[model samples]
Target: KKDIEYLSLKNLTVELSNLVFLLEQQKLKGLILDYVDLKDNGDYSMEYNMRLNLEYIHFANVEMNFFRWRDFFKFADFGKIILEFDRLLLQENVLSYIGLLNSYKNVLYLEIKFCNLYILRDFHKILNKFKYLQTLKLNRYNDDRNSSLYMFEAIKNMNYLENLTINLPYRGVYNNSDYFFGMQNFKVLCLTGTNLTQEIPNIKIWGNYTLLRTYIINKAIIKVYDLIEILKIESLTKLSFLDCDIEPCFNYISVELSGIKIKSLDFTATNLDVLKNFDIFKEFARLETLHLSNCNLKSGWLTQTNQSCNLSLKILHYAANCFDRNDLNRMNNLEVLEELNLRDCKFYSCGFFELGNDCKFLGSLKYLDLLHVEINIEDLIFLKSFKNLKNLNLTLSDADFFTAKNLLFYLPINALSLKECNKKSIFENSYSRYLYEENINLNLNSLSSKSFILIRI
Candidate 1:
């Protein structure tokens, strides 16, 4: 009880006053009550008039059928409030819920998920009532009526909102770009499954959002031209396109521009073939982090033409591709690369084990992920060239005890992962299990003499 700083109560029945008393006695910092039935016991309500100050309060999967919502807020003053209900039955009107939230003077962050907010008409207008909210995340289940259309119009005048996320799958939030005509600057804007293919009459209006830092689009339909225009925002740094269909607007012609200051660009699971006309590095000259995972890039994709360009990329994720040694060797311009992820890349019989000899990026790489890429004991010797490599992931590489021992003794990595698959062929063998345990013991003993290393099997 003395050591406990946070308490979690799930799928239980407890009086709100007793819960508060328990937290007060222990001086707990946070509380997570999931699927709990909270009751208002008037017996101790008057005795515990003192409000309990908490760092965070999370209520998830709780059915509000029998719980008194108004009574729950009076006992605690929370810094961050997260109310997630799978199915919420509001006994009172939605305004009462908003009033209860507005009464809380110290809530800085709030997240409400799957609360059927779309059922309430004009629900977005009441959002500005939470004047102290700095970060707000509202996720609604998709409805056929398109109720979320007026969602952005409601938060346009929110003066204190810096971070906002509106995730409503298959919902068109706005019809035109004029929805953000006079909006204040945001630090982060994350929208999933929203339509952003509207035409902008004037590009200068979007430049007003200079304070925007990170923009993330997941499974959204956005045009390539609109994306390029949005990248022109002055302070925007990180941009992610996850499972998004970015249609080419420039008639299959490569578009080039300068002065875009974005640092991180993620195109994970995106259809890169749409933008095959443009050279990504040449287009985003200041890009520091690039993720091109699962883009179906094969051999000869990074050819001599790529060698002529010098890249400023620090991290490169080339997972789930078909790049061989020749393709990797062409990336010699990645001298400043700090992290390289070649996970699930089919380097079979491609002499990738000797990649350290030709790849100039190995010296500067701090983290290397080779998960699911087969490596034998003979090729393991080449990994010694990674002098600055700190974290190495060799999960599912099927290394034996001797190979594992050699890695633990030779590599200067802080974390070495050698995760094995759960197949009966590997796990059922007693000899393999013996070797695995022996390898753990050897690695553990080496940690004492050498620098600290986290070995995970």
Candidate 2:
């Protein structure tokens, strides 16, 4: 073994062959032949010797290009094995690999991502064989052309598995039926790119599984009511919905979630009217953080007649909405409001004026985003009233009156975005002047030329 280690052969095949021969010859204690592409050159004797030295081996990214099935079976009897067959055409070899893995009852962690295991018929049998398996991450690249139905059922039978992350293409038919059945020991369930529709599945069985802590349903069309109902289960504390369509009102929330006690909520790119009813907020008073990005509020007529009743709201985000000045003033009752995001809201002139005064009442506000809002010199002065303001964003150049220089002198912010501002020289001059006078350095980082400047204070 020492002779082979110090040999330093140039050809990888020769080097690996020599190492394998030496390992078997001396009966080595440990071996690591990772990423050494071994070809089947019609010589099965060398492969047999390599497998014989598999008492203690950790193979990683090992290309099994035309390797014998018998050789792999012998290699699978190791104390610990790490197999990586990335881009290997496992059409006829999957059954043999599964059979090999099933023999090893002591496998701890198995991660297979982007492999060509098209037909997973014996997947359940394979999963059942691993009695001591702790973690399993199976991510397959499937599309509309190849829709697999029994994949979920194969995964659901793994009773002893603790953590599971399944990333497959959208299969609405299969997801609606038999996806959430059996084996309820998952602490974290992450379903990515699954075509889950708006209709709620019969997940009454999940309520019995108290171990589930994190549930992430991304790129689906799940309704808000269904989500709230799912959260009604006491164990869930973290929930995230990405690119999902949610109703604007809580009228559809038939089930109550007030007692669920969720800590974190992410409703990114979902509808804003989901909070229209306010019953869910009034129920779940223990909410610490809430995200509502790309949530449109065109229908949320913020007249004195229609005010929001969600008093417990702390972090309010209205990214990519069409809220005016009145909308800002109406949310003054949110006394504990910590962060306010108005990114891409296309704010009019009056919107800035309203924010300057009305926002002062929010004593707990730390982050404020007015990105892409139309603001002038007066608006910058109005922003000074926010004593608790930690961050602020503004337009680089005021088309109406103010320049970057005038805006810089008004407030001492931490980060600034001056991208696409016609007066780049003005910003540099103002920042240099501020540094000379107050001994404080200031720089402007532009988000867009006409859009806004983000300043971290």
Candidate 3:
């Protein structure tokens, strides 16, 4: 009976381990362990046994008892492993404890955040010996000026690497030193919190494997010219700039074609006037989706200029701006446009009337978003003219004038989202009122329902 209980407990522990793995799987890659306390877990023997059984492991805020170092080292020799030690109170003695797992060559992804600088230096030296390493992400907790440079030098030594992401928390300029030297075959490179005031380092120096498809810059103070130089690379397809002050003519002025076949472009606080000229669009003829948020433009610039380019544009999103009805009318000419998203654009009264009359060419539109626009419910009623609209989003609008009977009249609409509206009392007042009075399903949720549906707040 005791043996049976032991086996049951073992199975329960395995199930718990799998559950923990599943919970962390979504946030981090592969596996993640955050702040596991080892001191109060009684004997250190079971922890070493668990590590031995775990083929893949990720640790964040984990505490280890130094007494089990030998057993843990032996168990780490099995398969893939990832160790993340963030905000650990190592008490100055953690370096020797960490040195035991230095020979783990099969670790595919490794991340170390917020450790003593000296301990990190030793960890860097240990990581250099890993032959099969693919990804290395390091975040320095200290504010030392030369810490990032030191980490860079350590990374340059590792030759057999594919992806590298680094976060430099210090306040200084990152120069081309020993750190940024040896990443010749790196397919993806991401740098955060570094003072990249000048142009991005020339990517041509990184050899021909140019697998850099995605690049993100957050709170960067670099100029538009600097960014244009980086875009000259032919391999980059996705680029995002957040809180960046890029010039309007960055794309127009840069004559060099990076050969970059950009598919999606996201610009926030960046001047898009660089794309005002039709020549830039010709270069990016393959662009499928364009996202422009918080950008300043002269209302009808995009609609007028985009007519000249041979764009296979399927989706165009412009939010949080002042666009006139004429701009919306001009977009109807884009015959291939499938999805149009215009949010927070304070429209003049009867703006929807203009769209209804002029935007007849947008017959192919499947999805339309007009959230927070100051329009009447009559505009939504007018949208019944569109024969192919599959999804409609009209959240936070003053469109409550349309009664349930009026909504049942529109038959072709598959999905309608009117969240947070001023019409919750109507649902209670009409149980079978819509069925008897209007002859349509009053509480319909399916897309196929041609009845009056209400998704109340």
Worst 10 residues of 3 by lDDT: 3-12
lDDT of model number 2: 0.56
Pick the TM-score winner. Answer: 1
Clashes of each: 0, 14, 10
RMSD of 2: 8.7
lDDT of each: 0.63, 0.56, 0.53
lDDT of 2 by residue, 19-132 (tens): 566666766545565455555556666665656534444444554544554565556455443344555454326345656544556566665554544435545566565556
Please report the TM-score between candidate 2 and the true structure: 0.60
Residue-level lDDT tens digits of model 1 in 1-457: 5878889998898876677678778887888988887666555434444467678878786533222454456566777877675554541242355555544457778777766534445455555555567888876534433445455555665667788886633323343435554455578887765344422223345666878899887776667777667766768889888877777675653455567778888888877665556665555667678788987776656552333224677888889988766675666557788988888888744755656576777678898887667766655677887788887766433345444664545654334434442333333433234333344322434433212223434
Sorting all predicted structures by TM-score, with the top scorer first, yields 1, 3, 2
Q: What's model 1's TM-score?
A: 0.75
What is the clash tally of candidate 3? 10
lDDT of 3 by residue, 1-457 (tens): 2221101111112233343333334222233445445433445435534343344555555455566544555564434544544444562345456456546666666655556443444445555555466777655544344645555556666776677766643444244442453355676666555444533443344344367676666545554555656666567777777656554442345456635577766676566665555244445656667777667666765554345222366777777766776776666566666777777665543365466655644467788776656545566566776678776665422235334346634533332334333344446645335323343333544423222334322
